[model samples]
Target: MEGLALDTIIAKAGARPAAALACASTHLRAAVAEDAVWRSFCARDLGLDAPLDPEDRPLPSFKVGKRLREDRTLTNYMDAYKVWSESFGMYPLPLVKRVKLFWSSLKGWISENFPEALRTLSKGASEAQIRSAEDDLGFKLPMPTKLLYRFCNGQLPFSRNHFEDVRMAPLGIIGGYVFYDHSVNVHLSSLEQMVEETKEFNLDLEEQGLPIGPNLALVASSWYHPKTFILNCSSGDLYVGTANLSAGEMMPCVPKSLIKPTDSDMPQDGLLLWLEEHLRRLQNGMIKIRPLKTSRYICLYPEASPLCSSAVTNGVKVRASAVFAPEHPYGGHPGTYLYSYSIRLSVPEACMLGGVYFSSCQLHSRHWIIRCKDTVVSDVNGEGVIGKFPLLLPGQDEFVYESCTPLNGSSGSVEGSFTFVPGRVTQPEGKPFNVTVAPFPLQVPDYIF
Candidate 1:
């Protein structure tokens, strides 16, 4: 037994069938999932491998089926490899194309949502000034992403949705153009910085005299910065979406959907397919659904969903959520006081809290959306800026439109039930909904940088 051959040891292990196979030849054991084993370094890798020396490369394809195939050791193990990407969140993620488009739209979405980043960059953007930023971040900027940044920085014609139309239009000016003020500060700086730094770095490329743009555009991320999201423009399709963050989570998330897991429902690999389908169904138009049979469902808002009901995708099913307040439909907070309008949201159940942020504390037993806002009691009236409004749409059925209250962060923090109403829904018996509520709603927060 001490001098036994490898296969002989395997035979003995089969005969003994003991618990100590850990000490035995673990490698000789039959593959639990043979296809998965092959998939780790399959045909795709062979055809399109990164530039590696002939000596460093793996064996190319051999005939199958009729061949008496000899077993070969796996160079890369897929199961064990997954842990490296754990920081990116859950796995078997959405299509790469979607992720790219998401990043592109993300550049735009963040531009749309957070104009502060654009405004700060726009106030003083010059060719050299942007170059310094590129040195800081370490990547080349593409013409399009740059243009969008300029648009955010108030350099071009773009819509600034953050403030009231009357006020924001004047404030969001760039290059003597009104729409240019719609730029985002962070994105503009990042773009300007990328373009400037790369120009010098690619001096070698100029020496080689090969077309230069591909070097800047071909790679998905910057060498200096954490890879920014790149939109998949293969199909000219784009997604409009937002990123949610937690104390410790990773990106290009593998988890099909984000949820506050409960005692009953838990997260698992099976959920990936569900997420993929949900993204596909909402590539265009809005969708609203309430399930009578299932206690839980997913809400997919892939940035392509429409703003109005007529375009809502009828076949798609998603989770319900609430809204954030500030830029209310009718404008300033004062006018919408004590008033209510149905909120249009990705998942309808979101409501105003933290005054400025949206909180989903009512769902799945944890706080979903929340923000920190300043509060001051008014001498003019008992009215202080109560500071939050949960948005609703008219068709939603699970909850009711109730009075708003300021939370001190304690509901015993259990998953509680509530009713939902459409943004268009009205309470004939109570104060008119339209007169009261106008409300509204990132990814690795830029602070991580």
Candidate 2:
């Protein structure tokens, strides 16, 4: 019986007649439960080493083999096996250590990629401050949150907006105050404030009918619009609460609840995980910050008069400035000026830009080339300024574009016009019109004076 293969022996046992079974010879149950049998089965099925002493571990080879045969699901079993193997004689790293390591790596990455933004981060909070905050809030902060504050108290930019006006509160105000200085529409509240507001709104939680737990906390907020990021302190879950505001009243919270679970739409993760994921998204271009207005101006360019057609008040305003680009020059033209142009256009209303045509008075028509991001957009008789056109919104709205053109002469000027088409909703019968592009000087700095 020991020499026989396990499958052969089982087959033989099953093949016994009724009478032979009544006369029952061998201890088949004991044979099946034998250590050797289970060890072989475990090695064959799970590819795990058979334990020398089965009593040493909670999940022995016999139990593992039985589970594998009965369920045949490997995922859960593999996870358990990994935990059991790795944690045999070691304890996991403390949460504080793990968090410190994560912040260190994140800070290093931010410094390398966004040095200006990195400089805005505040110094770490002291242990006494952390304890005081915990006492005031009446809830223990998560280890990761505490660890994060140890590196940076909060990120506030005084002179310039960091990361495109996205500001984060200091540890003290994250749960209590809302930031209104940066935006007109958005407001972020703390956990205590959310709870108080929930009561102030006279919202019927019972009628609202979602699992409104007591563990809700405000993690982050954005004000460009009314959006709030929340975290469930108990379950480590995440939510986003958006409100429809009218006359300072929240329309979205009127009927059912002031705020409800938005599981389907929001990222479901802890605070630290969400921050890490957000940084990753920013790095990957999943997140973008559209510049609201132009930041600077150069006086070297002659401003083109605002061009207007029938019924348009201020038509379209265009401005241009030129700078030297040493990195990108005409392939073989040495001493030839490589001037990069920054152009901005302010549209008065919602309209579509059809195309832009570039012309130069100083450089030859053949030498004039419009290049974007080091790639040539058009040369001389080119079709458009860029491959794709964009639609601009109304009221002091601005759109920016950049292009590089080479000149054979020491000094030259470039001028162009943009084709505009008013939105059909605004002017149902309107046709496209041309707006003058401001001609800016493309002379080297040495010759500017």
Candidate 3:
């Protein structure tokens, strides 16, 4: 054993037996419990330093050290370690303390950085109002939710052009799904309206194979898509629901069908935790920002160069570029200029680019016709760039495709997005999201700005 490598001897003895023997031995206890032996064991098994007192008065005992090492060997523990390592800064405090800290930090940040963007429909909700809303809904609001209402009755509408936008509901209308209440109406939904809407949405969800728990309430909704964010009042878990736009009209005469619920990858501690993480990311520049007002097509992901733009979301990068072929107009039709567009997509993580969609303002307005070879590929109102959709493979980090759009006008533009599907077998119902396509100019070389 002395001549053999430590790992070789350990392998011969086996992990369990060696650990048990080390714990039980009294004669060789001094040698087995040596600082160097425990340090090596800790490093090898747990990828951590052995525990020791500040003054080094008492080293970790064999049982304690072995227990820690053994715990790391468990699959669940390893997974937890990976999450903790990745999210340490994102969630540094426990849920109870974190919620308070988050609200305070958010208030200060908004006041300092976005004071004009902050508008309240009313002062904080009174206890009476909270009780009435809860009683009407048949569920008590979570404490974090209550605390948030105390800060602001509602928030002003700020454009969230990117997929990673963080939007929270005003306390007055926590259960409302419409974005216009914040943007156009500048008012929060009353407690009575919230109850009515939640019940109605829940009924619709039941028909969609995702019946909302009585204790769960809608917290926020995305402006960019038909997705609703929800939180369980009792469990404090967050969930997302995407509308099945293809499911036809929500008419009573229509037959009911299954509509999937998309789960957010955020922690389950509650809305407070989710908001805190997002705000922290924004403060630290981890999140990208697109201006609320812009003349250019909303660049969801800004580009480093004017010719190309890229944006990364959920571990996928979507890049776009364009080339003009003014001399080669489609169908030999004069005034119809040809533009070549390219999408360079990369999915380095465990996700796939399920589909790509391209639409232009000019195209939507019936000003452009797109063609492939000699054939007319798209009418002005076509669904996407190419008539057919293609899937990006799991390990496929790079994909390039070119398409030509023929504009009837001398100058116009084209822009759209890519859809990403997560690569988890267990995530069958996961919803896809759009990675925005930066707008590219299509102009005749002689056309002046």
Which candidate should be chosen as best, given lDDT against the real structure? 3
| Tens digit per residue, CA lDDT, model 2, 401-422 | 5666666655666655655555
lDDT of 3 by residue, 251-292 (tens): 111111211112232223355555555565446643222223
Residue pairs of candidate 2 with colliding backbone atoms: 175-190, 186-223
In candidate 1, which residue ranges exceed 4 Å CA deviation? Answer: 1-36, 40-193, 196-449
State model 3's lDDT: 0.43
Q: Which ten residues in a row have the lowest lDDT in candidate 2?
A: 357-366
Instruction: Please give the clash total of every predicted structure, in order.
Output: 78, 2, 1
> What is candidate 1's TM-score against the reference?
0.21
Candidate 2, 25: how far from true, in Å?
62
Task: Pick out the ten consecutive residues of candidate 1 with the lowest summed lDDT.
Answer: 173-182
**Candidates' lDDT values, in order?**
0.26, 0.41, 0.43
Q: Candidate 3 versus the native: TM-score?
A: 0.35
Runs with alpha carbons beyond 4 Å of true place in candidate 3: 1-98, 120-122, 156-196, 205-212, 223-225, 245-268, 292-449
**Residue 143 displacement (Å), model 1:** 24
Put the candidates in lDDT order, highest first: 3, 2, 1
